[model samples]
Target: QISEATDAPEAFVAKILQPLSKKGILISNKGKQGGFTVDLDKIEHIKIIEIILATDGEEIFTRCAFGLEKCSSEKPCPFHFTYKPIREGLKSSLSEISIYDMALKTEQGEAFLKI
Candidate 1:
């Protein structure tokens, strides 16, 4: 449903599922009733960071401002200092959250904007 609503491609969907499937965070069924569904018990164990990295690639959160090949503390980009905190915060949040938490919040109408 989410994929259909967002019009994401199958490859993108597969990418998002790959790591989770490997980690048993999501279970894929095969049959007439087969489809993807969350494993609530394991969902909280999988960090959102994994999903983000799998689907969008880590560069979305950890890319240099100047597109340098190996930007870091020693070889900082012009905007590295300014970008560092925001990037860290984003990484921190993603690593901390889980699919289970998100679903509960959504069910309770406590977080996120409606589409």
Candidate 2:
């Protein structure tokens, strides 16, 4: 259902969900009627950053915005300083945003996962 709604391939979705399940962000059951389920009690504590890290890996937070092989304070890219603060702010916001909060906004029509 989620794969259909997201318009993603089932295999792709399963690959992504596996990491989340292993990270304890989601629970997966294996059986004829098995599917992934989230623990409602922990949903409010699940930050967006957790999901990003689980599926996308740490590279999202560490990779150079300009696709440079080596970008750092010692040898910064042209867009590094300009993009650094924005990247930091985005990470901060994702850390503070919970899945519950996102659902609430979606329910209120304030946000949409797909448009």
What do the candidate models score in CA lDDT, each in turn?
0.77, 0.90
Judged by lDDT against the true structure, how good is candidate 1? 0.77
Error of 2 at 34 (Å): 0.5
Q: Evaluate model 2: give its TM-score.
A: 0.92
- Candidate 2 structure quality by residue, lDDT tens digits, 60-89: 776789899899978999988888888888
On residues 10-94, what C-alpha lDDT tens digit does candidate 1 reach at each position?
6787667766666566778779976578766677777888777766778978788778878888989888899989988999998
- Flag clash pairs in model 1: none
User: TM-score: which candidate is best?
Assistant: 2
